[model samples]
Target: MTTTLKISPIIGNSQARRAAAASFFGSMLEFYEFFIYATAASLVFGHIMFPEESDVGALLSLATFGVAYIARPLGALIFGHIGDTIGRRATLIISLIMMGTATVLIGFLPTYHQIGIAAPIVLVVLRILQGISAAGESAGSASLTIEQAPEGRRGLFGSSVTSGVAVGFVLASLVFLPIMALPEEDLLAWGWRIPFWLSSIILIVAYFIRRRIEEPEVFAESRRTGHTSKMPIVAVVRDWWRDLLRVTGACLFLAVQALMTVFALGYVPATTTITSSDMLWVWIIANAVSAVLMPVAGMLSDRYGRKPIFITGCISLAVSVFVFFNAVGTGSLLLVGLAGVLTMGVCYSFANGVYPAFFPEMFNVRVRYSGYAISLQLGLIVTGFTPTAAQSLVGVGVGPAWFLPATLGAALALVAAATAWTAKETAHLPLHELGTDRNLRLGKRRIS
Candidate 1:
């Protein structure tokens, strides 16, 4: 369908700031739950939830981590509709609660020894719930923040969402550092639970912030004028399928993130002398730098254009995979740390910072939430399996096969860069004209 959008007066900066803060904190809560589960899977879940040997348990744990990705697209569809029809603020609140609830219950769950096969099954179910919560978290937050942002500064405001992601990784790492130091029995039995339990505190804080948020004036106007699509998913697929595919391909840049953060945590320590503790420090340093620089990347994208920053990130990440793995092979903590900072904190932030603004800007307000969430989550399904897939690629042991996964990540990054190169630059476009008209002539219906 052909869709046209009308511009609305910009809301007050105070409200926009509130929306950004809310989105930032809410994203923080969501990803904090996410990384903690990842950390637990890598460090604890397999032993606790499965009857298999350590290797099998670890694989199962990683598989549970990927299981959530499978449910994310379903979450995107359900929450996307709620976000588009009911309102962004409410959808964000509901999503945060779902994530928090799942994380906390996981903290309290019974082990396989205590409950037989039920433990892993329950864990997988909870992970799926987490996947669903995450489906809405970033997309809703990005859409809310960008829509509220001043015309020239959506990139800057949108950066807050990804900044939260960086901070979440930092928090997850820091929380685990002390826990990781505990005696092995205690570490497995109780220490890992602390981080998940901490979500209760974050949930309360994020809930209050989100409660204060108001809908963006643009979206409010869309509702008043009845400009909303009756079936946003149907509309987005019918009119914007190409954009959806482009977004999915561009999102493969996340393979860089998956290999760098999640897979490396397992791979580097096992094959080399580097300890998991050392890797956690690397992650902390990288993400701390990323949390700071992401906003800078966003501000730069505002001036330079989204495609340049995004494509640059993809290229940098592709190159850095070789450098990072080389550093790992050398067993130099400093080299590895520096490479991690460059690959994740600096390079990946460029794309991560801009995408919140870039993706949603491709769709009119009527289908923006559905389009952004569905496309983003669809790509993430593959990303979620990267660590597991990487492990499988190594066969019996890591050996020189570590490079295999790194090479795979680099290739995906290049593919994302190429896909991004083909997209129209949305940074300087007026909000109402953000999407393309390349497919307009093929539409059978018109949306006004």
Candidate 2:
């Protein structure tokens, strides 16, 4: 007697679409919590949490903001291990809950005047929880989307994760726009907490959606074969170190995001004539535009290849940072908004769109989360401090008129661009074959 083994059909395109939508909405909520804190740190926290000396207060507030990134590596390690060993669905659901809890706690916490240094200390601890929760978010979502995506459209589906980030920023700014318009006393006292508290609704919605998602097929296969890494950290360090370095180098593009969305808002208000509301409206518009453009760019990468699109974005972002800061110096809202849109919406979208597919594709399935999470978080630590570093470098007219910060941001973009160019082109490769160094034998000619 002969026995036949049947393979299940690949998940349908409609199911992939549903999964992508779920991943996108969940990511939007997660990042809304993350970016809102960054916005509040740049705008309100200095006054309410560290009201002593102006510069020092700003630095301390930003430091508390940076504390989250420090926790990101730990989050990455813990969550990445779970993602590789257990499943993406469980890890993402837990991350959403942790982030929501931390954010709501932040909204309820007492200010420095009410509770002294304990307020800032508690804020820092909550921020750390937010960071850890965020560490697994993009990687988990991207991994899930890529595994489920229809053939030849992984780039487009995966890009939704990054697009969700911009959408989240837009939502965050829009949510806070009215709140920030309140009287200064009211805003610092109460209005500022509203956005953080609203995160509970997002958490509930995300949890419901994410719980419906099944584990990705790739991860399930790894588990069945017992191919899952016993120690994801050890596997990442031993097998995928090169990809880790490349991804970390590439993640520096995040500094452009941090600087534009966080530091620039603070810098413009302090140095120029722009109000916080005006600056936030600029963010709202830029991120809204990015939400539209990121998918288009990701689609383009499918045809023209990821390297060119990724390189162009990095170089353009670097150049645009200087142009944007100079536009802010002009103190014209029109010019400032244009600069924000160009940098965040157009230029940054290239990197943002491609990285969701690009970074994870550089690692084998067994260690994909570990490699992507660790490298991405390490690079993010640098970006998290960009605002504080930019502030120190901009002291009292001794520096180069915003040139120093802009230059540093551009330099990081350049590093990302170079790293992208050096990476293997995986556009035409099948998902199973990705992340390996192999030669394609075409018509008797071998191509890498």
Candidate 3:
């Protein structure tokens, strides 16, 4: 019989708290920058930078948002390597600086009227940089925080990181809500740039907060013992592709948010007479509620299992997505708000809350960052192009063209559920036994 042993990790309870806090701040700050870009892309970029054909410019500007996803894998490769060989702390700090500096620079950028064709080109470049920085933020923080937590509590801590993302969505929307209320000309001319500029204050704040956080002991232990992989991604591809594929498939649930936030935010405003302020508040309030629900959902994952909660969330989200878009189409503010909260805030929270624990636990600590980052970002590339596709299909028909976002979102959530069904139950596994458990030792019985 396998006997339980009293555990000792290099991280103590205090450091665990610090890791959780750092993870939360990193996720919050990184996604805050991202949502700001998303808002600017749909609301302002088409108007200011791509002024040729406002409609086509809007589509093209939205595509630039997708362009960032392409750079994410590159960042995953680079930072995942650093996270595996160097340390999570350094990799995260560097990524935050890169993402933050790029965002601030975008704020100072000249509009197309002032800069000609150079305007959209520069914005795309900054956006790619932001994407690269973002590639590692969530994965690195998840792996780091989960590794630092005690055996039974990994889900809660990891979920804290994702909860920060909910907070980021809320904070980003809140920052843009008043700006959305401005008159058209003022919004296009100068008001659109204010939110981007305000990120500077937070970046300065995030840097200090992240600076105090130390490297996780699991990564440190691996480094000290020379157990780290020379090329983490290669190792992952060679030995762990099954888990990688599963991670990618399960990550399709992210489509719910992509469609709901990016596609809906752009689609609803254009299709019907829904006010921009109303749509913004829908997500703002939903995400604010999600920030509270996310951690609680994570705790449920700890007691139950990741797959059940995740699958339930996926199915719930599928139904919710269809209803959310239908609500938006009807021009009912109450239904739209209710639908956004139910899907984005609650259902999506259940699925998203589990992944922080679920993803990292699928791999060993050695390649955890690489496996999680590459898989997660690679999956995101599909969802990233959704807004562009939705824009292109904007008034095409009553079938696939019109209902693309909602329909595709529901379908992808089902795909995620199917994949999640195949993962081994991991809730009861000790942190050390997580990925390496099914090896030669599994068949040999030991009496302790």
Best TM-score goes to which candidate? Answer: 1
The 10-residue segment with the lowest total lDDT in model 2: 439-448
Q: Write the per-residue lDDT of candidate 1 for residues 1-448, one digit (tens) a residue.
A: 2232232233367788999999888888887887888888987887888985555888888999999999999999999999998799899999999988999999999889899999999999999999999999988999999988888899999999999988988888898899999999998888889998998998999999999999887788888988777788987898888888888889899877877777888888888888999999998888999889889989998999999998998898899888898898888888999998988888888888888898888877878899999999998888999889888877445556667788889998999899988888888887766654633566635553
| TM-score, one value per model | 0.95, 0.93, 0.94
Model 1: worst 10 consecutive residues (lDDT sum) = 1-10
Question: Predictions ranked by TM-score, top down?
Answer: 1, 3, 2
The residue-by-residue lDDT of candidate 3 on 1-448, one tens digit each, is 2232323343366788888888887888887887888888888898889776665787788899899999998999989989987889899999988988898899888999999899999999999999899998878899888888877888888898988888888888898988888989988888888888888777787788789888777678778978788888877886778889999889888867777788778778777788777888999888888888888888988999888988999999988888888887778889889988898888899999889999889988888899899999988898788777666666576764457667778899999999999998787788777777533344522211
lDDT by residue for model 2 (293-335), tens: 8888888878788888899999999999988988987889899
Best model per lDDT: 1
- Positional deviation of residue 259's Cα in model 2 after best superposition, in angstroms: 0.5
Model with the higher lDDT, candidate 1 or 2: 1
Model 2 clash tally?
A: 0
Clashes of 3: 1
Q: Candidate 1: where are CA atoms >4 Å away?
A: 1-11, 52-55, 395-399, 436-444
User: What is the TM-score (0 to 1) of candidate 1?
Assistant: 0.95
> Which window of 10 residues has the lowest lDDT sum in candidate 3?
439-448
lDDT score for candidate 3 against the true structure: 0.84
Provide the clashing-pair count of each candidate structure: 0, 0, 1
- Which parts of model 2 have CA positions greater than 4 angstroms off? 1-10, 51-55, 395-400, 438-448
